[model samples]
Target chain A: MPYISTKTNIVITKEKETTIKEKLGKAIELIPGKSEHWLMLSFEDNASMYFQGKSDSGIAFVEVKLFGSASSSAYDKLTAAITDILKEELELAPDKVYVKYEEVSNWGYNGNNF
Target chain B: MPYISTKTNIVITKEKETTIKEKLGKAIELIPGKSEHWLMLSFEDNASMYFQGKSDSGIAFVEVKLFGSASSSAYDKLTAAITDILKEELELAPDKVYVKYEEVSNWGYNGNNF
Candidate 1:
């Protein structure tokens, strides 16, 4: 694996989970990894990207979570394409948005495994 | 869980995952959730944040991955603190960096669980 993993989180107005899922699913599909590596995508709502305890101005930050697949060098092209899709689909400004990644191992889930 | 989830991805110049980890570890501590929740943290080497097939100008995006315990609300304050830490610790401009979170479920790591 290239071991090139990164993630960012943003807070968007509430909409269909499918909308977010579809957009992210497209990006995840583009990530550089075998189909079985751990690729995570998580979510948070009514949130804000705080800089010094406040919302990030002008731009938006997003966070995604996942549980499977890992990458050394996947998702670079996917993020770039995602920027475009967010702009075209959500009508958000490309310059005002970005992404990040966080991977985990041997962890728990919602009061379980940790 | 509050069902509030989001994520973004970016690329950065090659550096120690520990540096990124320290900045993020602080943020993870700040998330408003019960301890031992599923909060993922994965790393990648030599990456770049893309916006429509190019680098994001003057700003940074981050993606965070996970394996266990889902969160509906937590980690908000943590990302903000991380933003400050990145600026102070790394001397990075606050306006140029942000974070995203992705949570995963029923997943595997490396060539295992999918």
Candidate 2:
């Protein structure tokens, strides 16, 4: 399964947890995996700041860890999808929501691959 | 050499770029590498939102990709240092700045292994 984590640092209400979780859940479900994987996520508020003369609308420091099957294309698509989702859901500019994807192999699964 | 990248989504003044780059420059220099590696980073404004009930001071979606020497202790320290620096430099609350760290192996370097 794809162990996914949708971490964000933004101002959110307690009521918004469900919405955020739901969106992340859907995003994780899109990846190829067949098991109950751990999904860790948290949010931060007002962590992002703007810089002048930049191409990105919203830029973020993203680090994701997943293990199951791996594909660069899927990785790329997921990056775009997750970034897009965050942008739309959070109403963030493009350069604001940066997504960095990581894929661990079966061996990299912390001895879980016996 | 550790190919490191420190991506941020915070408002950075041109004056701040020099300071930001200085901090990041120290960080990258700490890691071991021979040739110059790619340090790609950008900033965003407000991609983080609070969830009310979270332990993390600053929750961030941090994704880092580095390839050079391998050491989890250094990684851990690097994480803590970078996070701490961001917190102190920006004078942001503990939960505002998030740092994601990634390390790629020689093999993961797209056949960079000679």
Candidate 3:
């Protein structure tokens, strides 16, 4: 499973949210063994987030959690794709986006650990 | 910084959200060198989450990311405390909650990396 959780200072509309999910689904698919079916995503807009002590700046924090390991190069690709998606869809600067990854040992699904 | 992002299938009210933030702030302070000032929390309810093949169950996904490493026992303490908070605030079963921890090396804040 791959879950992409994004928190941003920008405000999101219903249309933007739909487009974001679609774009994120495509971005996740760039990694082998990841697909939209197992992808879970949540976007938080107008979040109380501060970057360099300023909360009004346009910033995005993205956490990507996957079931297993990925190469740094693979992560780099995913990061670029996500950054592009946000920049294109939300008018956010690529430099303002932060992407974090986690290779999880055990992920719970269906009341059981996977 | 400590960011606790909670995604659950339960519907949340405004009052419950306030109580959750307060309780989570306390939970963060339970760990040494952590406090409410660096705590950033988000609660996502009625989310699209699936466990073990079913999406209708009462399940919660909690992702906790901290700037540095912590003892497994420390993580255990956090998992228990957060579970308890969700249980009391949202009447969710402890077993239904899944807590994930990540020790991040590079965290960005206020337009700078920490």
Which of the numbered candidates is closest to the native, going by highest lDDT?
3
Q: Ten consecutive residues with minimal summed lDDT in candidate 1 chain A? A: A1-10
Candidate 2 chain B: worst-modelled 10 consecutive residues by lDDT: B105-114
Model 2 alpha-carbon miss at residue B20, Å: 5.0
lDDT of 1 at B40: 33
RMSD of 3: 6.5
Q: Please, what is the TM-score per model?
A: 0.34, 0.47, 0.61
B100, model 2: CA deviation in Å?
Answer: 11
Winning model by TM-score:
3
Lowest-sum lDDT 10-residue window in model 2 chain A: A47-56
Per-residue C-alpha lDDT of model 1 across residues A4-101, encoded as one tens digit per residue: 22223344454744575556654666654422233344444333332222233433344333344445345345446556655655554554444443
Top model number, DockQ: 3
Q: Candidate 3: where is the Cα deviation over 4 Å?
A: B1-5, B13-60, B64-114
Whole-model alpha-carbon lDDT for candidate 3: 0.79
Worst 10 residues of 3 chain B by lDDT: B48-57
Lowest-sum lDDT 10-residue window in model 3 chain A: A105-114
